[model samples]
Target: MSLMSDIIAKAKARRMRIALPEGSDERTLRAARILTDGQIAEIILLGQPDKLNAQAKTLGFTLDGIEIVEPVTSAAYETYVDEYVQLRQHKGMTRKEALEVMKDTVFFAAMMVRNGIAHGAVSGAANTTAHVMRAGIQCVGVAEGFKTVSSFFMMILPEFRGEHHVPYFFADAALVPNPDASQLADIAIATADNWKALVGTDPNVAMLSFSTKGSATHPDVDKVIEATQLIHARRPDLNVDGELQFDAAVIPSIGERKSPGSPVAGHANVLIFPDLDAGNIAYKITQRFGKAEAIGPFVQGLNRSFNDLSRGCSTEDIVNTVAVAAVISQAQA
Candidate 1:
């Protein structure tokens, strides 16, 4: 089965908890309703209860088995406040302000996951990337071994006339603006882990650049080469190669010609760009012009599971992301 099918099957069997801070957007509401009715998991929506109820009724929707936790009533508030105070103790945060910040739906939702009230979180359809991550850092923080947060795009490409519909993974597009060698190493590690879980395949990561190997003499190309070596040194077990042009990374003939003896040369599933500008543009071009469907900008490396959504995402995006979150929660469990 495909990744989506696998996640859906897991959703049917496990009672995953998903926290949506933006609450009642049409896509979120629709996704939550579908999950609840289909026995996918328990969805905890963040916001005022009466407002959510009214909106649901107006849209001819039913809350039914879904759980709604308003900011005031959430058990996570206390937990978040404590964590926030600790994380920001050096930054001079009062307990009262910490409590107030916890009331913010995103913070509260992250706290829910931090305190085990929810399994994972999905937000950013109604908030900025930094704000969503801030809620996560100040509350749940980064994953055990991960030092910083990284992001990826779980892009889905549809088949067309004998073409294959394989999903591609691109990383650090929505976070880590310009990663240094160390940050690049972290990105490679995180992307490798996520690929194993979501795509069920070992990622042969390509550290993409405009030049392949030492064929070109540019500082930018040299940077990619350095990052690749750093990543390899840090994670010797990971199958990764760098200083590769796009064609060399994906095309077997070109890859073989460029890097004669590399495991990740010809077939790379996870593509890591050197900087955000290149990463973001490459993915967008593929998503729009290349006829690929983009699913994430999913935040990784957090202590707990917290995902973000584009404001313009569809109901299907919400559903897929929630499923991704479910997988993450299960993996963390």
Candidate 2:
């Protein structure tokens, strides 16, 4: 099966609950129908029930089996507000502030994930990345031992080195502009874990740079080298190599010539770019010129499975993201 199909199948089998905060969005409502019909997950959509129902009807569908919660009127609203205040009181958050924040669907959906009302949450369509991520971090918080919350794009290549349809991961493309060595290492570790969870395989991680194994030198190269060492020091079990150029990381002949005998060279499925400038540009180029299917800028390193979408995402994109969130929820559980 294709990677997305496999993930969707897994989601169907697990039948985990995923909350969608953009219930008023037409694309989300359509995707909810698809998720419910496919049994991918038990979908809880947060919005006004009457408006959502009317929208579904106008769109020629019925949300019969789906659970819709109006955030402020929800039975768990007061409880969620109390929990939010407790969780954020250290930052001087008051009950009144918590009440207002909980009224926002995105925050409410994230709280649902935090409180176990839903196994995971997906938002950001019709909302900015900053807003979606803020809700996730504030409500769900970062996972223990992870100091950074990053994002990755699951790049499904149409063809790679004569193989058809290979899956690779590109990290920090949608978050973290210029990461220090430590944050870069954290991104590598998090992406590697995500690859294992979703692809069911050990990740061959390549920390990408302009230089390959001392072929060149610069501060940027030094940063990548340091990040590689940190990954080795912290996660020695991971098959990771670094300071490699793009070609050396993926092309077997170039890899052998540039970084001979490196386990990750040429076989790297998880590509950690030196910074977001490289990662963001590379993923777009791959998507456009390489004709690869870029599935995410999915958030990682959160305690609970909360994902963000592009504001311009399609209904299919929402469905795929929900599938990914569901699978991640299973892995976390």
Cα lDDT of model 1 by residue, 196-307, tens digit: 8777778899999888888888877777788888877777888899888888887777889989887888788899998999899988999889888776878889877898
**What is the clash count for each candidate, in the order shown?**
3, 0
Using TM-score as the measure, the top candidate is 2
Lowest lDDT 10-residue stretch of candidate 1? 156-165
- Name every residue pair that clashes in candidate 1: 142-303, 143-302, 143-303
Q: For each candidate, what TM-score against the reference? A: 0.92, 0.97
Q: Please, what is the whole-model Cα lDDT of each candidate in the order they appear?
A: 0.82, 0.93
Q: Report the C-alpha lDDT of model 2 over 1-333, residue by residue, as the tens digit.
A: 899999998888889999999999999999999999999999999999999999999999999999999989989999999999999999999999999999999999999999898999999889998899999999999998788999999999988878888999999898999999999999999999989989999999999999999989899999999999999999999999998999999998889988899998888999999999999999999999999998898899899999999888999999999999999899998
lDDT of 1: 0.82
* Superposition TM-score, candidate 2 onto the true structure: 0.97
Show model 1 residue runs off by greater than 4 Å.
159-163
- Badly placed stretches (over 4 Å) of model 2 are none
- Model 2 local distance difference test score: 0.93
